[model samples]
Target: MKQYDKKMIVKKSNELIDAGFELSLNESRLILYCVAQILPKQPIKPDEMYFVDAKNFSELFHLDIAGVYKTLKNAMHKLGDRWATVIDKNGDPKEIRWIISRQYFENQGVLGIQFHPEMLPYVSALKKHFTQYDIKFISRMKSSYGIPIYELLTKRRDLKEQTFTIDVLKRKLKLEGRYSAWRDFKRYVIEPAMNDLNNEFGEFDATYKTVKEGRAIVAVTFHYKPRNKSIPLFDKQGNPSSEAPQKRWEEYGYRSAFEFREALELSETHEFDLTDAKEFLKARGKPANK
Candidate 1:
């Protein structure tokens, strides 16, 4: 089957953001990406439901047959039951669920889902004050918390910081009962997600500090910087990286063959002969002896 470039927008309601909710990050990302693929370029209509082949979803996400099946089953069972609670300007609380209806065709290898009718306006025809981001940002994220934290941080990227009360933080992470102790939450949840973010984005990509009131931890302050877009020179280890080295002689400015040899010595694995080194030096206007 011809594969189209899979792209999607993660559009969340302002009310939903304030209310906070939980989701299996893995399933949520996959579902949003799949739905976005079938959506028209214009605003999505409430009546519209998307039907996608299991094979297509697998290809887009680079999942194997088993993974595809597992993802479908997870989506059908797990995500179908997920819901969010939000409050309106009138201070009325609303319970918002994800899917209005869903079906899976096993023999035909198809899954269909219609997002809740109320959600269409939020996910589609988004104008302003919405937390919107490309689907690609979360694709490589390992931890479930990475995407949620990223979304929250990116929304406040201009401020370069976010402060949440301990309770509010738990709600945002949907970890109400999971990690009761602050230490456990920091170690297992926050640290791992930040590490993964930095690993993929850059060192110190997202960091946080505790806020305390008279020794009682009240809240946490999260600070983030834009991902370092520059390419890395060395690998994770401080070694001569395998990535292709500078090609131009001017780039390195080796004065003699000895300098070139010295550079290669750092690698300790690159082999160089005198004759080959001589030719290289001559081409760069450096004498082998000098």
Candidate 2:
């Protein structure tokens, strides 16, 4: 097998990775492309305009090239309003903009972004404990939650384990007011993100242990370190084996707990039970998925 070469490396401070922010997959890719250009010890000039082309964006994220120009334009236009909440050197929370300036070169099919001066401490001149990873790891991931989860795991690849409170996890991922139930949270968010990482990412293997306060899950501890170095991301046949969450879920005789619940008219707010699904399929003389 030919070795996979990660041409662009992305690095960010640990604080930034754990910071609260919500961005579409395209928006995340655009930011990463710009960050990958930074040299470890070099200075990033505020006046310097880094450019991102639709063609490159499409190729990087496996997006449709024809639609990428519009995608790039929209993400760039909205990125200026997005902010990251970081704890400053004095341990006070400060909200920082992701972009100080955005340039649209419509005819050139490219967009330019200038980082905010406030973002300098997190993105540049990082001395230690910076989260670094191959951008390709998320290129084929289909879920929005996949991107942040990958970053969360990458940030702790050096440690034996790092625990995150359920509240903190929800805040960092911007999942507030949603997935209030643990089952729904795990089924829809956590599991899919972990599936994506375990299959697509090559640098490390990630797994988690849940901590419960009585019967309620209150926190999670994530563990990571490289187990295998080679995981084929793209090949002639198709996307990586774990790219589609539904396909993986099919092996258990259901697309997912959601579908299994839907078939029996169970509440999404309630726990997901697949037992009825198996009996339901058997009653119809249908074999469950192998």
Best by TM-score: 2
Pairs in clash, predicted candidate 1: none
How do all models score by TM-score?
0.68, 0.72
Tell me the tens digit of each residue's lDDT in model 2 across 145-229. 7788778866544354778888998988778898999999999888887776677544557788899999999998878765542
Mind giving the per-residue lDDT tens digits that candidate 1 earns over 50-154? Answer: 776777666654466566766786766776778776776688767777777777788888877788887665565433455544555565566777766776776
TM-score, prediction 1: 0.68
Model 2, residue 205: distance off in Å is 2.9
Hey, what RMSD does candidate 1 come out at? 15.5
The regions of model 2 sitting more than 4 angstroms off are 1-6, 228-290
Candidate 1 off by > 4 Å: 1-5, 38-43, 52-56, 59-62, 201-204, 228-290
The true-versus-predicted C-alpha distance at residue 55 of model 2, in Å, is 1.2
